[model samples]
Target: MVYKELTGTSVRLPANFTGKRFLTIIALNHAMESSKPVCSDGITRDISAALIRNVTLEHAAWTETVICQKGLPYLLQSNLQKVPLYNSTTCLSKCNLIAETTLADYFPATHISGSKDHDISDFICQFLPLYTNETLVYLPNDHIVLNWEVEESGSQVDDFYVGLGLDATEKDSPSLVDYISTDRKPYFKHRHEAIGSNELFYIFIKTVNKAGLSNIAILGPFLIDQTPPQYKYIPRVKISEESILFAWESDTFYDDEQTAEINQLAFQFGRLSCV
Candidate 1:
């Protein structure tokens, strides 16, 4: 039996099996258990099942056949429905587009932080189309709006103007709000009540140009009741009777991103004498 450390699953095989066959058996078992047959690594469950179907694996071969026929028939049928087909004419046509446009870095660096009672807002997140040239007048003017949804609640919103208002809410759903600014800065301010543990809210930005074409950008998921980060502590060192001692607060008081500078200052102070 081979044990998988990550998923806590095991695969039992004949004692005679070793090396590549042993590896294959483990991969197939994990795929069956996890249902995630696709992986970045080349060794995936689908590939393992395919090999087992064609090759003879002693006693394991019968088990693989039973699994393929019974355990995965529904999944295989669903997969077969998604296979794309192209005719000779469509495949022969020359493609003009050099590269397809994508929202690779659509998320902004800023994020909303703090608790429900003191919800803090980040500056406006911005996005631009990959293939657009701003200097061209015919490109059309674009307007952005804040969008949000409730996590695990299947609730959605089309778009909202910049500014804070209790615009959208439903039974068992997150209340949708926005903060719009007219000072020429494109950003939305979001605020909400305190959330319980495991509660989540999803927020994003959507843009529509004058041409009526729309594109969406995500700000990622937001969680509630997260422990607020503490301010970093600077350590102080003291030496007496050839023994050295360091002291600092156990609780974090300040929350800043200057960890490197704080470390430098601590090290510099440690090297100095207080006698």
Candidate 2:
């Protein structure tokens, strides 16, 4: 699949996810209740959060020491004097060896994301994600605005596409999925998922700067409608931005297993979005 620019010509930077740290990997495992400790980077190892943090802290100190040694060469003057007989190339090689050794110990504990020999895990990194909150507001002029709260992740969120269909099976393709708008903004006003209740609807999202429709996320199998049954227009709250004031809520967020299932179904319609 080819990436068709739906917003504009310029490239938008992806959202930076907090899960970049080792702590996030631990959190993800805990959240998913997985026995195997692994990160999206494909590094699988049984490790504790405390150990990881300690290793990270140690690595930081060691790095600082290395920087200090580089800035103040005098710190190694005594050693250099003893090794005066050694050539400059030998000295440089020894320094490089020390750095490699020091890094080898602590790097594994922190940089467990992936290795050149290993492939990245999609389930932990790409598949398992947190859901963001959305707010619905009704203007006095009958204008409806959906404030979609984009959640933070280890990946970048490019754009979101809100689509309405008869069922999950309907409009399975990104091209077929009813898209209203595309942007980096968390809020969508012109078109949203809350359109009709007679059919199922969904939200399709894109993450990363990959080509085609491979990295797009499919969220939802909702029954959203503009005017809910006997729905009286409620005044918008001016307090917190957490509350959603939409006509009705969208049911795109699902359980882990169910979400995987829904996502699989959505991927089946990939042909529509892929070139």
Candidate 3:
């Protein structure tokens, strides 16, 4: 008669027995394991007064409500015995029956004040477009793709909010009103022109679960570069009888704090016939 999914602070017991008197016991499972000698005489005596109850039934069908603490395992037992009139003693008779059951608290207790301190890092393990180097560089017109992974435990995530700001402090303490709500998809895409150009920005993500627990994750100090490289002066060419030389001057573009160098250069040669 084990109850598998008991939750909250109370339990209802409906019983149908053919006895004049009944004894009910509800105690923590750990306490019951250590104090098994209380029922040595089969009459369930010497038990804690608070954990035991005596019930006299007027009808065969009866309901009893037991109050208990949440988030713990408990053992419940009901014994139907006979009281002899001659000896005035309670004893187990041939018709006596004992029913034992184990009850488990399914829903763990939640503290509203402590929920705000929950570690969001456990919920989101990874965030995309991370700044590995000095900065995560991107072009102004490029679509920024953000992706992440959520932990499998705890309550399901009900909503996601993303925030983009120009400073790290903004990411640390993001305003919910400034954040954009998103679906449960693991990835979100920021379309071109959605963000301003040539600015360093930080990304903040907040996840709220169905239980009202929320956590925030921060990523980036990414840079969006709108300026392109430009030539400082016109190219100069030198031609000799057997060889040719080409040279040009250009302004350096600093990417990753390093001067951008040309990886390759191409040229085409053609012969013109005199008519």
Highest lDDT scorer: 3
Candidate 1 clashes between residue pairs 3 or more apart in a chain or in different chains: 162-179, 162-180, 163-178, 163-179, 163-180, 164-178, 164-179, 231-253, 231-254, 231-255
Least well predicted 10-residue stretch by lDDT in candidate 2: 54-63
What is the per-residue lDDT of model 2 for residues 77-155, given as tens digits with 9 covering 90 to 100?
1011100111233233334443222112211221222311112222222222211211111112212333333333233
1 or 3, greater by lDDT: 3
Q: Which regions of candidate 3 are displaced past 4 Å?
A: 1-136, 142-155, 172-177, 190-196, 211-215, 238-245, 249-275
Better of 1 and 3 by TM-score: 3
What TM-score, computed on C-alpha atoms, does each candidate reach?
Answer: 0.25, 0.24, 0.38
Q: Give stretches of model 2 more than 4 Å off.
A: 1-145, 149-154, 170-177, 191-197, 208-220, 224-275
Task: Give per-residue CA lDDT, model 1, range 150-231, as digits (tens).
Answer: 1112112223223221212221222553433233223443334433334433333343332233333332223232333455
Compared with the true structure, all predictions reach lDDT values of 0.26, 0.28, 0.39
Off by over 4 Å in 1: 1-104, 107-185, 194-198, 224-244, 247-275
- Alpha-carbon shift of residue 35 in model 1 (angstroms): 72
Q: lDDT (0-100) at residue 24 of candidate 1? A: 33
| Models ranked on TM-score | 3, 1, 2
